[model samples]
Target: MELFIRPNTNEINQVEIENETGTSDPVVVSINRILQQPDSSYFLEGIIYKVPEPLRSMNSEAYTPTAISIGPLHSGRKDLKANSLKPIYLRHFLNLAQLSVNTIVETVQTLEQRARYCYTEFIEMSRDEFVELLVFDACFVVMHLTSWQYPNLDTPNAVNLWQSWNEISHDLMLLENQLPFFLLQSLYDLFAPSQPLLEHQSFIQIVQYYFSEHKNPKLFFIDIKPLSVDDVKHFVDLVRMPNTRMYSHEKSDQRLLWPLNATELHECGVIFRSGDGIEFNDQGGCLQLPPIKIYDDFEKRVRNLIAYEQCHIGNELRNRVSNFAVFMQCLVQSDQDVKLLIEGGIIENYLGGINEITQLFNNLGKHIFIGINYYNSDCKKMKDYCMRRHHRWMTSLRRNYFSTPWLCASSIAAILLLALTLIQTILAVFTGFKERS
Candidate 1:
């Protein structure tokens, strides 16, 4: 027996009525929606983006802001304790600048649309909402940064009074929890004139000084030329600016086929040296890497930076932060590799566990893609050096025969004895030939 199902009469009547009325097709509606969207060129202007899901899934905590939310993307999150303090900071900021709320709000309103375009996601808030968010958040940021410069000078009490400065700094550096640099610069320009300390310094200098003083100054400031406000997208971009100078612009078809980890490279006569940038010395067989001090927040910092590169830096050759992470991931495979790097002064492991450091690098590049890795040529050179038979033979000889003083003396004696025996044998053969003659 076969069973048949009848269509609902209401649906049939609705289709008949729709046909009679010449209702629009679903495809037409979709096309209309597409037509209503902003031009495709507008998307390229977006500098702030949500971290991609694949990367966020690997470590959600690394990308999510814990202490505060700066922009529209994370404004709805209620758990952020610092949200309550934003208003207090804003009030303090107004008092310090002697500007009324309307003045700041009006200033932010002027740039609201441009700031909204800076975000990759379509901000769901109204114009008033966005302008208010920027006013409050930008003021908070300005006050917070000012507090660092003048801790005792009756700045915003709520800036660092309740929240941990480290936590606040970490959240500020997150890619998702960012406002446009232009927005911050605008706010700074308005209020900075009134404040004696910030009057002389540019916004970029204040930002650079705040981060350098709070975090590692050597890592951020040493050998890094100051960047203009136009050069940075946000705090994450500012952090990444120093590394951009080291990226190789040349592209290569070569890929790192057999990447040797830290231990293997060390065994193959590749010396690891701590430097300010990632570079390979082909003649000296030295792999120079920037010294990284790994603390508790180091993974979060690095992961967000890599995420920023994935979203913002279109040219793979320019993704220096991501490339460095990839290079480190390839270099560090195990705890032993971490130990080797630490011994070479290339890594300052404040997190204490060698295994954790190894795991951090191994997982950093999990969902990341590199169209052109900047370190590919350097790795290829190292691989070629490792593959040479003479280098291997010399390394083996040094390890097996000349590793210790006793072994070196014994090997020397053995070589001398062999030489003497050979000379004597030759003399004996000569004498025998003479006798026969």
Candidate 2:
């Protein structure tokens, strides 16, 4: 059913989330009607928020000094400059005239802040996990930007070789908050699942199963299997044609995707929605993010570091821990009102709990920082120690995680070799016995 929704924008007003197709009568939506006016407008899932768009793409080839833009809304990093920017590692960030200031990050942040202020209901997860996903998404953007900025015209790799960034001999650094989402997406396509399938039918079966398996059914963070942009496109197509089964039982080709409800379908159609909520139709679930700005040619260089990090970063658990800490700190300290789509899901507080928590922490921080000494000096010191230990535990976790892959690979190889040797010995004994007979 065709449901109408306001596209994500800087100028959002009362937007109605209509369930034109009477399928979903979930308590969440029913509750919403009672709490809010029918005509009242609200932010919905899958709505493409108005974000900074680079006017007439320009990269190193077209512009001098590699004048890449770090959009105001999206730059999570604290520093910004015009000419020479601070290098986070190798890439440089500078505001360009062509790049717009509006970004999804900013828009979302604005809503988050508002929700906090208004005490709106929010879906709560591990602060660190949510942040880790943010980093993961951001890394994807950086990877794409870098890949486009540094095209393979003068290099040996004309094919997608962003994955092999270890060949670089120079000390490269990004001078600012780099686009990370685009980076991850391009690389993700290059390395999708590679198991042998019987046919298109088998392939669809496997792929469908892969997407449906709920490693994090309620939360689509850091799971090994990530939903791609293509998946979203396919899902959009499905929404456009509701009668057609995305995945066919008899046909060799089937598209396995989770269905979206009226509100979810409408919301996700424009802005990307987290896969936790119920779509108008619950065929299954999806992780497909909406289309981001594509990075072509030399612009790809903005991403090499991110690519390298994903492939070479050994401390996965530790990295997650740190990401979690930062995310938690940000969420706990955030003074923003966040929004949560609790229409099709079973979130008790929805977006409300977040506001409550953030407010709780805000008050605590203010009291502690603003001469309202609630805790004694020793207690404060103990708190500090606990934080330090918490961080240390994360580092240790990462170390253990890094060790697993090598250990598993080596063990598997050894076991296979031993099995082969045993088979050979058994064959030899059987042959000798047959010859004697």
| Tens digit per residue, CA lDDT, model 1, 1-437 | 11111111235544554565577575644444444445642456788888999999999999888888988888978898878888888887888889999999889988887787787776777777778889889999987886777774345344456747688888998888999998889988988888787667888877877777654444534345777777788888887765443553355677544358998887887888887666777687898877788888888887888888887756433566676777788899999899888888889988877888888999987888777676777777888888877777777899899989999999999999999999999999999999999
Model 2 TM-score, all chains together: 0.17
Question: Which stretches in model 1 have alpha-carbon errors above 4 Å?
Answer: 1-42, 152-160, 214-222, 253-258, 313-317, 404-437
> What are the RMSDs of all candidates, in order?
7.8, 25.3
* Model 2 C-alpha RMSD to native: 25.3
Q: Write the per-residue lDDT of candidate 2 for residues 1-437, one digit (tens) a residue.
A: 12222123211222232343243444544454445433323232221111111311222222211332332212343331221222221121112112222332343343332222211122132333333333333333333233333332112342342342321201112212222223233323322222112212222222333322312222222222334443322111111111112111121122222122223222232121433221222122222221111112112322222222222222222122122112223323332322222222222232245455344323321111111111122223333333444444644554444448886677678778999999999999999999999
- Give the whole-model CA lDDT for all candidates, comma-separated: 0.77, 0.28
Cα lDDT for residue 321, model 2? 17
Give candidate 2's whole-model lDDT: 0.28
